[model samples]
Target: MNSLRKEPLGGGSSEPLPVAIIGNGPSGICLSYLLSGNTPYVKSHAVHPHPLLQRKLMETPGVSIMDQDLDYLSEGLEGRCESPVALLFDALLRPDTDFGGDMESVLTWKHEKERTVPHVVLGRNLPGGAWHSIDGSMVTLSQGQWMGLPDLQVKDWMRKKRRGLRNSRATAGDIAHYYRDYVTKKGLEHNFVSGAVVTAVKWEGLEPQDSGAQDSRPLFQVSGFLQNAQDPSPQPFILRARNLVLATGTYDSPARLGVPGESLPFVHHELAALEAAMRAGTVTPASEPVLIVGAGLSAADAVLYARHCNVPVIHAFRRSVDDPGLVFNQLPKMLYPEYHKVHQMMRDQSFLSPGPYEGYLSLPQHQLLLLKEDCQAVFRDPRGGQKAFGVSLVLVLIGSYPDLSFLPGGGALLTMDPSQPLSAKRNPIHVDPFTYQSTHQEGLYALGPLAGDNFVRFVQGGALAAASSLLRKETRKPP
Candidate 1:
């Protein structure tokens, strides 16, 4: 769909202008879609980290990421924790090719030295998936899953038969393509600014830096670096907007598992030299007992990957899956906007699992830890005489937190709520409950996971919806 010049609002003038959307995840893309055709009074600009991906989006036809395989590859790459080693390994290992007849046994030997913990892998849904486009942007899709659970019911109902499921992977660029098509079709492509990273947001009407010179002028500075350009030094830019939305998603950095031997070169984060290790036949089950920390989606993915590779796997977490995290609200509330804004805001939230939780071929969190404790439990091939490989790699898939060092004037602009102790380290941005505006400063908004603390518990859909709703409100003209 193309953007059309429409009759001006109130039959006087054209729509004033569109608002700017400063992030390119699902939330941001979805936000752009919802705002299109809203009286043409406001438009949106989606600021994407990768611009070339957005450019390539313009060539495709109607919005559809139909190729499932490409979708998996994209997810594998983008979702890789620190690097693409795991994906590299998958690429190199051809199907039906044996690392060794005793490949499972070999993997056991490696686990004792380290632990391969459970982690989540996201992928796209099957054929004819919805396409995201904005303006001239369009994208193509291939077969694969994109960091979400495969929907068996949907497939079964449509095809009336189930096919053997293959592995899925993707990269940041790949997903960006899917979104490009999604937003473009919705005629919201102009709402994005690609290749830009928002650095800091200066609040208007805030106190002066020195306080010695007092002048009440509302101004804020935004610093960011440009991509795909020849500038050697970190190029800086600034912005002056009445409102700023921070949609930078979670996983600002890999959460390190603080334990003995964690700092050793042999140990690595989720994105460590996965390809090299796999190619060398080094990534495998433990010869000693393997211990996995954290029992969330990431841990689940790690276990599944290891299982697919024929390696014996173990899973662990401080809490059970049924009680994954603290539940924000069990049901919708009768009264809205009552009591503390944060508390009331959470009443309508719900939790949805993205992958297989517990079932055949999938061991429970407690079972995995028991194997670690007893040292005799073997995860794969129960009937075989193979011994348990001692633990080697300990993959900690428990959880992640944000590191706010990137923001300029850090502590002065945002700080942790003293009332919440568990989330103190996270230091989530405290935004105005009603408008999603930062409480400490004006013209600054916090959306998505960064703003979901205490109330929302970090879900993707709600964060994006809230941001879009608030932005529309800010730009909407009165009747």
Candidate 2:
């Protein structure tokens, strides 16, 4: 863990300390909120820099903070920016504003014309021959496998998610709105910028400076920017600051399928586009067979969405049929006495009762298989296999690995391969659980999934760590 240090970097007099945070995910966003003094849930804990000190840091005309969004996501939505959650819309923006990408338009159109699915009925939780109405079936939204056990049923898990909690569908987008709203009600300056992706971060060490108050401390210079990766020759962003923080997230690197035809637009690294299509009714629910590869949360979410759209989904994995499903992986028979006995019995019979997935037999004759086939590569069938048989989409929910190409020279200042997992110590950026500063880099700090060594990467944990780090820094008294 790194202890927080504030040193002067000689740059310019009467200049505000310009801080640049890379990546706009939870970590970067949280850092930006801290600098602006607008974090509600975590503000009370930060040891704020003396206002006089901050004013000095802000004196430099070169000082400016940037987030990933140029505008809030709710800028155009009718009810998007109204509620407390709507605050996240304060700086919402479409990707195209900076990246020259057009995926947001497709998402919005789909959200408009897409069929409204109140929810989904999970067939896996039902008893044999158990029937249910379309709206009454239990659709599994989260899986508990990441918790370590594999036999636990999705419905029975609590630590994974608080299902009964209010606003079950609350997403990161919703949280962003809520945070922005809080800032508005408090009348704080919510300065933010979006529509750009950070391509690089250049760190310049600290220097001594005169405060013009008879005594001066060390200040720092840090600079970087928001630009498109597609540009052959893009302009570089620059900023100067007394202190610097790096909060780019693991997801900053887009994961790749490394398979053939992956270059096709139909295959996506994120569900933003897929959700858009579903919302637009472009991807209709029907008898069409849809195949989803891999068994992670993304795959589970995809399955539920397809089910809601009335699409018959076929889930294929490299795991054996005897291999555990999420339920088995999460709540194995040993952990739950009753379920264990039941699971053991089913194992003996080579048959198990229907649950979430199998429970949705309303249409009857839909197939969902668990296969152990490796996705060596993806290619169209010689005769357009099932696409002609109404297999409208072949969504490979296989996991994504980090793509460091966006980093200048196709790499980052910190070099840890996402392709290979680390054993905690070898990881980059040591964080002080107390101060959240990087032990190796004084002004640099890290938070979110990228900071922790937990096997399961979650947005909530990152937000919590970031909030804690912010509070600790705000509350600390300078020596």
Candidate 3:
């Protein structure tokens, strides 16, 4: 119920912003779209598998779906998705086709510019965030249609460019391009502050009693610098807002092994560097087998790519092939045959001798102990004996964490402990599922992967939740 100050940070405008979104990923783009008053409406005669939900939506024809009784609407809907409301949105969009079937949309969007909220989206990269930095040729786990933003389908965009999908699969480069173009295509370009790094964000003092309610929210000061073509140097800037949204997805910070020689030049964390090395012929089949660590999809991708180049691969992982909790095991085999193939190799190689996989080898239940400067990897075998293997390069794909170092408490604020990284699989931020708001931080919201909505399709629902909460607060008159 706090009435914010109209004072400028330095020589800027006096009016304070209603919202300031962090990260220009899909979540940020979708939130910006909503804040711009590009409202979504349920089409009349919108056919859904859930007749009761459809009936309720049709009754309020003029209301935006974002403003509907989301929790009630989300009930009784089951999907292979995280957010139920997001599943509801998918149901509305695709109607009866809940599981990967192609169909027409049942929702419509209209620009109601008058309802727009004043906000800014400060992002480190362009629009796609982590997608921008992924290997160009690598295929995405999700289908092409699933990667698109709400309005413009990625397949539709590809048609414009005279491109077609191969078995509905989209490459990482295509997805990155689609998200970058979505911001401008949807007219949300003006709201994004691309190529800016947030240095620090701190909760400042609350306004006096004259500001409105006794429990007025603390003012948030965001300090950052812009990096762009105009000036390569850092241009310092400051911004303040009443509502803060953290849409920063987990990708910037790569999780480390903490072993000696892990930081060596030949050792790579992200896939981009390894891809670059492979493409440049720096890593060849004649070289010692490339050592890959981790059992995630990224690790699988590393093995696949290495083998494709005729390079022998020696994959190391802590988990066994039959571990159901592994990321590769969760993917649908038909859609992700490449990943499953790598998993199959792990399974096949487990019982056989080392040379059974042709150019690939799996070290199941192997624990890496040390790495020498000469590219010799020391690992503890399943038998508890330490052994060494020479390798051309070491690729660590153990997954990544979000860079929340900008916060005054650093990443420890979000993860509770930096030594133990925040993981979407294990330690996602506990938020109000309906509003995506942080339970401990008033006026603060989380979107996208930070709030556990990892998929591109689910991210919009998180955005919608935040926008709905924001609009509700905006409409309430000061006490």
Q: Estimate each model's TM-score.
A: 0.47, 0.49, 0.92
**What tens-digit string does per-residue lDDT give for candidate 2 at 18-135?**
3444444433433444444432221112221224322332333232112111122212323212221122221121212223232221111111111111110001111100111112
Which candidate number maximizes lDDT?
A: 3
Query: What TM-score would you give candidate 2 relative to the actual structure?
Result: 0.49
lDDT of 1 by residue, 39-130 (tens): 11100232222243333323342322111122232233332121122222222221111221111100000111111111110111111112
Compute the lDDT of residue 85 as modeled in candidate 1: 23
- Quality of model 2 by C-alpha lDDT: 0.35
Question: Listing every candidate in turn, what is its Cα RMSD in Å to the true structure after a full C-alpha superposition?
Answer: 20.6, 18.4, 4.0
Task: Point to the candidate with the largest TM-score.
Answer: 3
lDDT of each: 0.36, 0.35, 0.79
Better of 1 and 2 by lDDT: 1
Candidate 3: where are CA atoms >4 Å away? 1-11, 208-213, 279-281, 350-352, 411-421, 477-479
Q: Which 10 successive residues of model 2 have the least lDDT summed? A: 120-129
Candidate 3 lDDT over residue span 84-186, tens digit each: 7777777776666655467678789998876688788887777888888887788888778888778898888999978777667898888889888888788
Residue range with the least summed lDDT across 10 consecutive positions in model 1: 102-111
lDDT, residue 45, candidate 3: 60
